[model samples]
Target chain A: MRIICCVKHVPDTNAQIQLAANKKDIAREAISYVMSPYDEFAVEEALRIREKNPGTTVAVITLGPERVDQVLRTGLAMGADEAIHILDPDSSITDPLIVARCLAQVIKSGGYDIVFCGRQAVDNDAFQVGSAIATMLNVAGMTLAGKVEVDANAKKVKVERIVEGGTRQIISGSFPVLITAQKGLNEPRFASLPGIMKAKSKPVTKKNAAELGVDLNTKMIIELLEVPVYQRKKRVIQAGEDGKSAVKQLIELLRTEAKVLE
Target chain B: MNILIVAEVSQGKVKRASLEVLTRAREISAGGEIAVALAGAYSADAEKTLARFGAGKVFYTDHDQVSRQNPEAVFELAKMCAAECKAGLILLGASFLGKEVAARLSAQLGAPLANDCIEIKTAGNGVVVQRPMYAGKVIATVQLGGAQNIVSIRPNSCVAKESPAEAQAKKISLDSVSLKTSVESLEIAPLKRPELTEADIVVSGGRGMKGPENYNVIEALADKLGAAVGASRAAVDAGWRPHSDQVGQTGKVVSPKLYIACGISGAVQHFAGMGSSKCIVAINKDAEAPVFKKCDYGIVGDLFQIVPLLTQELSNSRD
Candidate 1:
């Protein structure tokens, strides 16, 4: 089995984001980057499938500036056999259409049986690239999978899709399937010291946009970047060393001030 | 510009998110026609609701293929409807089905897509949209290029207002079928309160709640207040609640009208999820919990004592 997991390098989830001087993009200098937390689940699942079924090869792919190569290495250290870096050094491309095209182009020629992507990237939060790639490749996509049972011999897969509204929809399908991993899919493992040492020796294949002949004109561009304006009243009622009085003040405020409670 | 709104239907009525998109559609339509490709179980009442919500034209389908939200079917429907109206822009409610269909359409149409957008407007010949980044810390204003754009608006971000357009409703006819996947079954757990993302009021618990069995206090308050039950990542990771009930950066981002955080210390990631809420009330024993600083109201007392008292007092006050 040949499994490919697409991962993204994004700013650390805890990083404090501020707009750049132009106010059209995030200030990147001081921020540290890491593999998006959701993508870690995909990479781990890919490795687990490889472990259970011998002769399976797992490859990790990412599209971004050269800095994104680190995430591919992270995936490699976590147990992927190879890495494919679509080097967008300038990070000029922000369009999902272009990114999907570049990714689908590579995955289509690889003859991979399965592909995995995080439910969404923490940075843009578009969560569209994987499905778009599936559409471009014309394959069955089981998105937002919380649990996946793969029948390698039968070429079938059963997925528990996490649909909102507190429902889990069961989707049963065959191979050549695309799966997007959510948080609860599995616990992503940390790369060990020996694994990190071995990852440095693994092959990292670099590909670029021009080589793929994708249309360079980005379809989506950031117009402005700003902090969200908040109007929170930020009031903390005096508890007066007890519970009853504070409860009274809160209920009063909800009625007269917030108007949320009748 | 000619715009198409792909509306999702649940339990017969058009979903609130769909109607909310219609309200946004009326604004960006710019005198051009605004239409809706109302998918799933189609009804005249839904059609009328669409009309009153400013749908100038309504194209509907009741094909069993869309009975359980087959993404391919929904995508094909949206594609044909977009072609039918020559839509310059398309909008969806950013629901699960909506995002799925929109992504496929983006690939099929070779157009840019902005998903889960909060604010949308028209600038020049194209559209500009604002969406959250890093959960909600930074807002990115995006411009969708080309003559066509596909955008999905976040739920509860826009108000659904009545515009009362003359309806030109039609039965949708597809040129071909591309259904492949089948749903074995869709099990909806019996829910007593609303889901985290869609709820109007949410009462959430954190590590301070202590254990799974102790969540009853959280649930009790939630039941009395008519709100959804939510949990912080700490509680979820500690196995105190289901992942579906988590509200934070890793969990569902919520914008309920009122979010009551009980026993939660207000981690940054947790606050980022519910920070956009209209009103926030935190109840934690720790006075210096970060949640208190960000909330509209705070009560520094043990949730075990505070929550139950608040529930009874609220009911009595209302009576």
Candidate 2:
């Protein structure tokens, strides 16, 4: 069995985001980057699947510049057998389709049975690449998988995905499919000292978009970027000794001043 | 230019989000023909409803594939409709099925896509879309740079208005093609509360709620206000609420008319999910909690006391 998890290096969730001077992108400097949280779940799930079935090889793939090597090494420490880096010349590409196409071009030659991608990248918040990859490869695309059950012998798997309004769709499909990871899929483990040392010796293959025959043109262009402005009243009614009066005043304001309530 | 609005019908009722997209489409269509694809089993009232929302043509299908809300099926149907209508742009609500289908359709057609758009407009010969990135902390105005465009809009981003017009209804045929992956069963949660994304008003709890069982107070307030229940990431990680209820950068982003934060400190991530709401109210015991600084109204009091009292007041004042 062969599995590949596509990971991305994004700004940490806790980092304060600010627009760059260009106003079309965020400030890249002074921001710490980590593996996207959902991608952590994908890599963790891939490792768990490899553990359940012997002779399974788990590999991690990423498309970025030199900085992406950190995420790939972390994936190696998490028990992936190898790493594939498609040296992306443009990290500022806002178009998810080109990313999907570049990754698909490489995965097509890898002969992997299953592919894992995060539900959405936290940085761009675009939930397109995972399914777009599936489309590009013409693979059975299952998204937002909160729970996965694989039957390697039958070459099939069953997935329970959470949709809106709290509905869970139980779906079963054959191997050679794409699964987008959702939260609660699994708890990712930290790399131990020995694993980190071992990862240093693992093979890290690097390729570029030109060699892969992938196009680098962007379709969606960011015209402008700005910090979101909020017109919050920031009004605080002190409860004082009379909490009820404060509650009454707030309710009245909601009904009349803000007119949020009838 | 021709535009196709894909509508989702659940149990003979059109998804309100779809109508919202159609309404937005009617606004920015710019003298272009607006068509609708109401594939699978839907009601006549739905067809009429589409016409009332400025759909000049309604194309529907009952193929075995499209009835299940499967991504592959809907993608096929939409691809066909785009060609039939000669659509230069396609719009779908960013619902569970809509997002997946829109993604695939855009990739297959090689159209530039703008997903989760809050606003879209036609400027000169090109189209412009505005969306939030970095979890709504940064807003991006993007330009679509292709012959065709695919846009999936967020629910409740636009309000549906009636603009009755004559709609030429027709039926389209699709083959029974499955993606080799099929749903065995659907387990719908019994909770009938409004979905967080679609609700006009939202009431959310956080670590201040303390325990899972204490959500009843929050739920009581939500029930009275008829708002969806939301939870901050802190509450979800502690297993006090389901992941679907989580509202933050890692969770669902909501834009409701009224957002009541019960015992939730206004972290940037949490605010990113719902900072666009029209009104925000916070109730917490801590005077210095960050929520007060970011809310339209704040009451420095115990949620245990304030929530129930607010619920009682709302119930008494109900129309």
Candidate 3:
């Protein structure tokens, strides 16, 4: 059995985000980058499935600048058999569909039975790419899968989705199923010294859109990004001798300014 | 202008988030038709509750396929209802189900969808929605490009307002013959006492809580105040708590009336999850803890000593 996990290199969520002086985009001068937090679940799950079912291969694919190779290496260190980097070093694309198109090309020819992605990238927080890819591929897809069980013998898959207010479980008929893993799907293992050494020797394949018959120059345009205005910054109304007095003042602000309370 | 709400019901029960959406819809678009597109196997009790919350017309789709939580099926049904009612705006709760369904529905209907919105208002030419970006550090006003505006409001962001309107709804059922997916299995989490996001008061612990067994302080205080137990990413990563209880950028985003931090030196990601809370009370031995900056009240003392006293005082006051 073969599983393909889709991952992305994003700005390290732990870093402080500063709006560019132009207010159009995020300033990227000194920001560090890493694999998205949710994708960690997907990558870890793929590794475990390969380990549990000996003779299975796991492949990690990502679309981003050349720096994305670092995330691929991280996955290789964790246990992936191969890594595919669809390098668009010019920083030209931002649309989820474009990302999905690149993935669809890889999935169509890669001969993988299953595909996985983190529910959503914390950077964009759009939650659209996986489902969009499923739509493009015309295959069964499940988002926010809390648990998954593969029936290798019967060629079927059962997945439980974490929905609002409750959960929904669904089973798919065959391979080519796309799923997004939720947190707690598996405990992502730390890279060992031997594994890191072996990762350096693993094959890291670079495929551009033109090489894959996709237009790398095609870009999705985004309007200027703006941050919300905050007149008050880090000013907490410390509790005085009477806590009730502080609460009263807070109520007044909520009523008049925030207008959230009645 | 008309406000349309997708009345989300599962297994014949109306979700609290749907009621919360109705309240928000009313606040944004004052006194509109408030039409509700009700799908799934809704019971009679659920229909009446939908009407009680100012739903002028309840377009019911009682198809078995609609009963399943498939985004394509639900979006098809919602699109038909929106067209039938000629609604100017459609509001859905930005829960896990709502986000995907709303996105596909908007795509199919050629309408713009503003996702996980905290606020929505009728702006000139369209509706302007406010959503938190960059993990709650900044809010952005997202504009949808279409004739009819569609938005998914984030759950737990708005409280349900009760202004009972007496309007008997017209139920309409659709053909359920062509369905895409089927529910195969279900494994429910053991019903814990409190849902993390719904709790009015939340008492969260961190690595400073010491060990998994020492989480008793959080549980005790949470129990006394009828609150839910939460944990920081550090605690969850350390295997001291379940990932389900983790609150941070990767974890659940929550806003409660009161949030108490025990032994937690707040990280930016952790604060992003619960920073918008009504009142924050921090307890840490380190006076220089970052949590003190975001907290409304701070106690510079050991959580081991202060938690017990606070739990006892709260329990006594409740009695």
User: lDDT winner among the candidates?
Assistant: 2
Residue pairs with clashing backbones, model 1: none
Give a tens-digit lDDT track for model 2, residues B83-113.
9999988999988688888899978998888
The residue ranges of model 1 lying beyond 4 angstroms of the native Cα positions read A238-242, B173-175
Off by over 4 Å in 2: A90-92, B176-178
Docking class of 3: acceptable
The C-alpha interface RMSD of every prediction is 1.5, 1.2, 5.1
lDDT of 2 at A200: 98
User: What ranking of all candidate models by TM-score puts the best one first?
Assistant: 2, 1, 3
Q: What is chain B's TM-score across the candidates, in the order shown?
A: 0.95, 0.95, 0.89
lDDT accuracy of residue A157 in candidate 1: 82
Q: Write the per-residue lDDT of candidate 3 for residues B1-319, one digit (tens) a residue.
A: 6877887786677778888998887776666678887756667877788777767777776665566656656666787788888888888887766777775655444455667778777767577777776667666666664677678887778788776776556655556434334466543445454567666778899978989999988898787677788999999989898777888888877778777788899898898788777777787878788987777666666677677766665454446
lDDT of 3: 0.73
Please state every model's RMSD to the true fold in angstroms.
1.7, 1.5, 4.9
Candidate 1's clash total is: 0
Estimate the lDDT of model 1: 0.87
Best by TM-score: 2
Judge candidate 2 at residue A73 and give its lDDT.
93
Candidate 2 chain A weakest lDDT stretch, 10 residues: A86-95
